[model samples]
Target: MSASATTRFGMLHGTALGEGSVSVHQYLGVPFAEPPRRFADPIDWSAPFEGGVRLAMRPGSVCVQPTVTAGDGFQGSEDCLFLNVWAPAPSTVPLPVLFFVHGGDFLSGSGGEYNSSRLAARHRVVVVTTNYRLGALGWARLSEGRANWGLKDQRSALRWVRSNIAAFGGDPRRLCIFGESAGASSVALHLLSPASRGLFGAALMESGSPIATPAGAAEELAADFFRHSGCGEAQRRGGQAVLSCLRAAPIARLWRAASAATAPPPGGGFLDQRTFASVVDGVEVPARPFELVASGALARVALLGGTNTDEGSGFVLPAVKRPLSAAAYTDYISKLTLRLEVPRANLSDVLAVYPPRPAADNANSRGNRAYLYRFDQRARDDTSEPVDWGVTHGSEVPFVFERGSWIDSGNTSFTPAERLLSVAIGGMWAAFASRAQPLPPAAWPAYRNGSEAQLVLSIREDATAPPPFRVEVPPRARECDFWERLQALVRDKEQRVAAS
Candidate 1:
């Protein structure tokens, strides 16, 4: 059956997914911002359409970035600030809205990649996902005023949702901004951003935290981009000439330069020195997000955050390719500590706290009504062979979206217990969005400073049974304490260095 919704700009014709009561109305590739000018902030979409009607059936073009499978190649366009929406059919009352951002290391990914139909239909919530600029186009610090355009694009999308979601039977007042990995980091940044205040009522971040590229590192990345893009002469010319040269360059040339600038160094270290990330721009980002959260400078909103059991596995496994030798592991640790700005004197202490294969931990929020969770579910292949990745980064996304069964084939289909786990996770997320609490007092409790309680989501070996989701204090408490101290030491050193 066909579906349509009248947005502020025009009437949008969409399509329906599934059938009967489980069906959801999906509107795809809706523009939330105008076609962006290179290195400029996103402009909110407000003008009426010429025909007063728009076809939102197909997915929008993703932002320009290197192809995921092969980094050497490029795909997408600069004009890719679009969003998609999924709303339950036959809903009389306005449902809670969940606006999601996709994660791609600030390099790649789009909103179209995630299908939120299961979330919308099963949980009776309105789901929205949107694309932002990526790679150099999104994060390059070419000019002092032009950094973090991708973040601005997200804010613009939130504004769009606030103004128009009621037309689609969504509650703007009950909006929760949620994302995984890079998207999760973006949500954290929004939580810390002054401009983003009141745009969202709650936030959920999975497997990511509030981190920003230092100003010095951002400058180095920009210089590298200029050198690789054949804009070195423009750099000599200085001022707007550099931006002009970059804007005038071919899209392929820019993509290649971005790839080169952000490429991992020879011998492959644990942390790549050259990286593109959101910066602490004075206006938009104001200050370090982690520090703001520590100092209780965050916006007043309900918070739900989590990480997988083996977050570093995804990054480490892809790079190592083989079992690590003692020497190689030590070398990797040294490089990692250096990138983290840990002083050489503290190397031994850092190593003591973070032994190989250590259990991961989550940070506790002080002032907000927060709930934390750790996903301990490992992925299994078609033969039921455990995937070596071990609940690696982004593994929990399918469970949270209730799309585990979509990836199944024959015997590989998600077990009954696994399916139940998906339902439980998705339902918790929706409950948190609809109300501040993720679950009833008996199942999950709100996190407090001293209590530090969190949910551990895992399934038992009995495939036909229900999941065993438990709430308890996270493991590796001492390790978390040591890291907190180390972080403070590093921050103090950085501040002193900056002052000098």
Candidate 2:
């Protein structure tokens, strides 16, 4: 295999890997946008490189972000708008292209964290992973309509791929954008944004919803951020002066101020307003994303997504480290149960679906059928954190990327079952990119109205056979019913107030 690949932008020197029947040309750290100004949107700059062979052997630097948790701080240039690509080395025809957005809660993550060479080679498709702005710098709302630079960065990267993937033997028209967690939420929001239409024909979001902050909430957060940075105090000096002060503030100082302002989620919940992830900015995000999707405004693209069996487990892992007692478990569950807003009498019902049953509401309302699945396979490695991570948030990422060995399960090797699951899941994702349907062996079912059936990806234990999976209905249908009823009541109350 050659050590380099030629792109119109420049001759890229990259590493080559052999997987299955093909070789993968893995190129890392390619820029797609110019260095973004503080609080400004990313500027598209994918011009062809005139320089000699560019070494894309390493991932580009991640954007600057403050340390939210221990061992989670990363620092890089503000010019972190870059992307990585993995393509089948020797392709006879153009293959389907997949653009991936990484998940880091809109705070921390990089396109360099994932290596998609195996997925590209095994599926005979091209895979692209990208990095966008994060935290305050990426999501802070400015005086004008400037906001959601991270999302804008993603849009620019997609445009770059559409224009250049053909050189890598990829069909731009058949592109699919997929991601996990915040990345998933970004993909979901893109579906609602006119700016993102036609950039990708389909989407696959994992464990996220298009829940952007309301305009008022976004404004409040921005104000708090300014106050924390002492920029609000500078307003007496004039509005322009405030902007200049913030822009001129050192990156570390800005990071600290932003980190201090954003409050952590209370109780056991993942939504954080101060994180200021996505916003309902009229330009980039035209309207309330859920309403837009519900009205069928953006329904042409196919959608596929689902939460894991223990999606909430990741949020509470830190609390249950020392082998929880019955009372402790109940306390943990109660704090989590409050988020669902069901009656205390129905708490049992809500707890039954903590993993959240896969619903067809997002796709079904648009009269478009979608596919849903529950990734319930628990990893055998539990040594990283003291508690049970149990198919927690972003747990499926390793399998999807076909790098099961990379997961820090404290184990150096994978079980036969784990390896098989990785191959199967990765293959399904590849198949979806190429055919728009996950080719599950037990016959993946297309979601239908009232159909809680989903492809459950779990290791089944049988005395006579190895662990494998089969079709199953959502864990608890009654729980889903209860929540829908509860949500309807809340919606009715809001509508009545609006009418009044």
Give the best candidate by lDDT.
1
Q: Give the winner by TM-score.
A: 1
lDDT of 2 by residue, 1-500 (tens): 45676666777787887776677888889888888887776778756666757788888888886554665345777989889999997788889998999988798888887878877877788999999999888888774467888899999999889988887789998899999889988988887777788998778888877767778888888887888788887756765787798898887777767876786546632233257688888778766665566566664677788777767667653543356567555555666555443434333323324222332565666665577777887665555666666777777787777676444342335566676777788777777877788764348877776766677787644323433666777656766676556656767798899999
Root mean square deviation (Cα) for candidate 2 = 3.9
Off by over 4 Å in 1: 265-273, 320-324, 339-367, 381-387, 405-412, 463-466, 494-500
Candidate 1 per-residue lDDT, tens place, 114-158, comes to: 888888999999999999998889999876656999999999999
Error of 2 at 138 (Å): 1.0
Error of 1 at 429 (Å): 0.5
Alpha carbon lDDT of residue 13, candidate 1?
89
lDDT of 1 at 90: 71
